[model samples]
Target: MKITQTRDIRAANRWEIMHQVLEHSPISRVEICRRTGLNKATVSTIVKEWIDKGLLAETELGKSGGGRKPILLQPLHQAGAAVALEIDISQVQAILTDLSGERVLAREQFPTLGESFPQVYHKVCQALDKLLAEMPPSPYGLVGIGVAVHGVVDLSGMIRFIPRLGWRNIDLRSLLEERYHVPVSLDNDGNLAALAQQNLEQASLGPEGQGSEALPQSLAVVNVGDSISTGLITNGEVFRGFHGFANAIGHHTINLDEPVQCSCGKYGCWEQYCSNGAVIAYANTVLPQPISTLEELITLIRHQDPLARQVMDRFLTYLAVGLTNIIFIFDCQAIAISSELLSALPYYLPEVMRKMVLPITHVEKVVLSRLGKSGAILGAASQAVFQFFQDTAHAMEPGQ
Candidate 1:
């Protein structure tokens, strides 16, 4: 066995070195040693192994003070690939990405509404097969696949519930793994989106000398689409409590006294009030005429229609209540709101903040998701990328 693969601690250190390269590539061996707190000799030895494994490649030489210039190392972008699928109520989105998280192949999106779980699963598998067939031959082939489910996915990969689509207790991970013979990861959409956001933020931090600042250690991503869900990220890791059900903030009670029914059969659930569906439901009651979409409602608000304004105010109030609850519970550095509605009504962020009981400084921390519709799918893809890194840690293990 190679020296770097012998000890578990050394394997972990090697993984960290590769991780730094993946995040901030075209980096020098000296800088990698500095960032990872490893000796120069150890870094050199591990880099040799990775280069031989074709997982990493040395770039052009860097300037030197007196001796030979240092060789910059980066992830071998074409060595392997990852596939990510995001299953939503109406459609599924898929992408094939490289080790550096760059989309190597064209993405695919198809309808899923009114389709059975088996049908949706078949489409997902087909999508993966098609992408794989398109990829140019590489040493590592396909590393793994990650799926972002728009519902509660248990730790065992069983999808417990997705009320909007009427899905319940589906073992999606096993179904795919059994057929494809590839590693599979299943997670809730909110959590995966949050993970994607976290990775994007981290990747934005440029090379060692660049002045890019790091993201906050703790944050929450609240997605208010047809449904509502929150993903809590703490210290760069997702906090999936008890059966991977953490941050199901949608079902939390917000109006116990005058409870409104939710599709989940819950009373006064936050989702029933703050989701886009909830906003439409509330709008229908107050508007002179019923409107089904957020764009129409926003257009009415822009025209200064008093009734539309009233519904907007109520929606903001309920949303603010939910935001406050999230802040109090997580005490995170920031809360990122993801919704087509937020994009429609970006100007009302201040109004929503004003409704919050917290100080203006704290309330100002709420921000809209920068990722938009791509967050969940990209996040799902990131999971496969993460697994690749873990496997890379032990790439030199006997018969690995």
Candidate 2:
């Protein structure tokens, strides 16, 4: 809980004090002093300002000896609200959470529109409108919208590239700004998923994972749906390399000698062999039947069909090889597989774990994400939450 002042204080250090209280609330002035190293007088000044601003409230008195009550303080849950949005070619998911990443409200999902970018953007705005109509009116408007896309993106809302959606050089941020008239943060979905895992498991991660040993300094989140790839976190920060192009493990050539066309304009990429599409293709090759969704394939695998088992086995093998490289390269604390894919892994992770050790002996704990399919949106929202709490000095500007 200890927080060091990272920058020059402004606005009476309002955001910093509010952030610390939000993180370690129901805490006394003494504890706040100890955690933040801010003098008792300065802490008093900030706490009073927050209380007056309707941003924090005093709870029970403290028990620092039999003295006058040192009132406990916590953030006002309604001081502000943030919107998180997930988008792709197929569907868009949204959630509104408070500063603590807790959903104080409901979630919304809607089908994506036609091929036109403007159409899909309108659909998203409509979805937000619908969700907002259902909420109880409050003074705090939406803090900002955090958008998660499927391509490379800078902090600006530009869609640098997304082949599935055929979006390139699209000014998505500016478009959203025109709609919401508020700040907008944009990032790729994979990184958002990684943020979701970190936020959802914060109590169980960092230097404090559930087990005896401390959490690893690195993590890799792999989403196995229409696409196969990874998002990496190291030392508690997303690692986007020189050009914001990192952790595209799906394009890693797993089948180097066996050439096949890949979605990323490559040959023999791993996604061609390990994605859900690959699983469906393998099943169709053996069973000669059409399959519509990945969920159906899971049902077949659960039933122990030979074709399902055969495809799953190969899929797990290739997945482990790529994940093994991730393990070796980053030596992460844990690997989080999406919940949609974990069910099949229950029937296969034992074998995957066994094979993962085929190349390396030190086994990192591999776990299934607890957030389900909503992870990307939740993750994107968490980015907003963190951004909202961070001191201004650390806050990267809209286009930075």
By TM-score, who's the top model here?
Answer: 1
Could you list the CA RMSD of all candidates, in the order they appear? 3.2, 4.5
184-216: candidate 2 lDDT, tens digit per residue: 788877788987776555545222124455655
Compared with the true structure, the alpha-carbon lDDT of candidate 1 equals: 0.81
What is candidate 2's local distance difference test score? 0.70
- Candidate 2: regions farther than 4 A off: 1-7, 10-17, 24-26, 61-70, 155-157, 205-213, 344-347, 357-363, 390-400
Looking at model 2, report the run of 10 residues with the lowest lDDT sum: 391-400
Model 1: residues with Cα > 4 Å off, grouped in runs: 1-6, 62-69, 206-214, 257-260, 359-364
Assess every candidate by TM-score: 0.90, 0.85
List model 1 lDDT by residue over 1-400, tens digit each. Answer: 3454346766787788988887777889988988889999999988898888888888899878689898888888788888888888778888888765557576788999888888887888788788888877888878888998888888787899997788999988888778777788889989988988887777676565344455768889888887788899999889889778886788889988755567777788888887877888889988879998889998998899999998888888999999887887778788888878677779988888888887643632778888987788788777878777777777675566
The candidate maximizing lDDT is 1
Clashing pairs in 1: none
